[model samples]
Structures are given as structure tokens and as C-alpha cells.
Target: MRAGRLRHRITFQVPGEVQDQQTGEMVSGWETVWEKVPASVEALSARDLIAAQAGQSEASGRMVIRYRAGVLPMMRILHRGDAYNIQGPPLPDPDSGLEYLTILVAKGVNDG
Candidate 1:
């Protein structure tokens, strides 16, 4: 099988409580910031998607993504103008499944 090249924008939601210091009042409102993480598929290893992000190679695949250690609760893989949301624990391994590809915007790295 041939590895596919993909690109996607990962968005992260920031959480915080709103409050008014002037009158010590609790503010009720929804505030969120969207961050775009651009990833490029550099190489594919049957088990991983060798991606180039922030001038480095990061392995991303079913298993690697499922068992990713950190604050990545949700991730979306966009390709061909479509988005696929990846969820659940780390994946066991790569399978003969289809993925997507998308055009990412020019932006800085994601420091999450």
C-alpha cells in the first residue's frame, strides 16, 4: 500500500472562567480562541505518518495518535476539503483505511 500525503488544521479550544473584577461579579459569556496547526505529510511508514511540523518530523497514525500523551483531547484530519475527527484511545496500528488531505493556512506553530 502507498502512504498518502495529507495536510490539516488542528484547532484548540481555550478554557477559562470569566469574571468582572470591578464589581467582583461573575461574568457569563462564551469566549474561545481558535488555533490552527498546520501539518505536512513528509513520509509514510505503514504504521505512521511521518509529518513535518515546526521544522521537525512527528509520527502520527492510528496507534500513535490514539496513544498520544498530552492534552490532545480531539484532533481533526482534513483532506480534499473534508474533515475527519479522530477520537478514542490510541489506535492499534495502521490499516487499509482511507484518509484525507487539505490545504493548511500559513501560520506559526501550535505551542500546546
Candidate 2:
């Protein structure tokens, strides 16, 4: 794994319950489990297709980073202030000796 490729700053956020002051309802909110994380991000070719869809401005991309525990598809990633919802399960790539976690991210969603 090249250290230079993992230069992009990213963050891992998961849904958390927060009590609404007025209604007392437990509202969903994003809690940053990890911040300022290092990752290698790349825009997938199909991202343009996702972004072109009507009534949706979301896009898709790929991120490569060192493996860590406790990250799931339910969690979303924030890169450069853009929210990306995990589209699928995390795959570990050991074929190239990178042994990195490859995550598929969809852009523009996960605001909730």
C-alpha cells in the first residue's frame, strides 16, 4: 500500500439516536465514529450515470483504506463534506498485497 494514495481525509459516521428537545422523540442523527481518517478515494466511471438521474443528485464512488473493525454498510462516509452512503458490503482486497478494505459509496444521500 502506497502511503501517498491514502492522503484524502475522510470520516466514518453512523446513525445515532438523539432526543428532540421539544417533542421528546428520538431523532436519528449522524455520529462521527471516526474522523480525519486516511483513505484513497476514486470516482467510479458509473458515477456520472447516478448523478444524471432525475430527482436525485447522488453519485457513486470507491474508497480504499486500511482495514478496521466495526465499520458496516449502515454507516456512511463523509469525504470533503460530501456524504456517501455505503452501497454494499466491504470487501477485503488481498490479491495485490494491499489487504485494504474497499467500500462502495453512493453520494448525496444519508442526510438523515
Candidate 3:
């Protein structure tokens, strides 16, 4: 992957459980896992978005980043004040598997 393509910055968050202050009950929350990570965010085309919506799939975009381990489908990506839920596991570049990761994401979704 070209360095220029990863011009956007993104943050990754993972789901966590925290205790409620008053009730002392465990509640789902998000914890920052990685911040200010270089990435490339690409919104799906209108046709693709519509087709995915028709199929009841939430995927609306994709984010590419330099190859890193431990990225999972349960993680959430924050970019430009928007929260995107990961649609599936990170996929490596088919041509150069170690170069980068392609993550399917859905915008405007709850992080946890």
C-alpha cells in the first residue's frame, strides 16, 4: 500500500464492561484501544450502499490501515466524529497479505 493513501487518521475502540456508579451493575462501554492511527476511510458508492441496505447489511464503508495484529470484528472505529461498527474480521490485502488490513464498517451505529 502506498503511504499517501493512508492520509486519514482513525481511532479504534473495544467493548468493555464497567460497573454503574450508583447501581453497581455491569454495563457495556467502550475503551480506546488505539488512537491516532493512520488509515484510509472510503464510503461505499450509492449503488453499493443501497444494495447493502436492501439486504439488511449494515456495512457502509471500508477503512484500510497498515497491517496490525489483534484487530477483531467486535471493535469500533472512530473517524471524523463518526462511530463505525466493524462488520467482520480484518482482512489482509489479497495481493500483499502483510501490507495492510481492510475492515468493513457501518456508520452511525452504537459503539457497544
Rank order (by TM-score, best first) = 3, 2, 1
TM-score of each: 0.25, 0.76, 0.80
Please provide, for model 1 over 1-112, each residue's C-alpha lDDT reduced to its tens digit, 9 standing for 90 to 100.
1222214444433334567678887675323334444444232353333343443233333212121223233434433343333333222334522232222222223222
Instruction: Give lDDT for model 3.
Output: 0.88
Q: What is the alpha-carbon lDDT for the whole of candidate 1? A: 0.34
Give the best candidate by lDDT: 3
lDDT of 3 by residue, 1-112 (tens): 8999999999999889877789999998888899999999999888877786754377889899999999998888999999998887888999978889998898876856
Model 2 score (lDDT): 0.81
* Candidate 2 error regions (>4 Å): 19-26, 46-59, 96-98
User: Candidates sorted by lDDT, descending order?
Assistant: 3, 2, 1
lDDT for each candidate structure? 0.34, 0.81, 0.88
Clashes of 2: 0
Query: How many residue pairs collide in each prediction?
Result: 6, 0, 0
lDDT of 2 by residue, 1-112 (tens): 7889999989998899877789999898888899988999988675555654553234367888887877798999999878999876787886853468888778865787
- Which ten-residue region of model 2 has the weakest summed lDDT? 50-59
Residue 79 of model 3, lDDT score: 94
| Candidate 3 Cα misplacement greater than 4 A, ranges | 18-27, 50-56
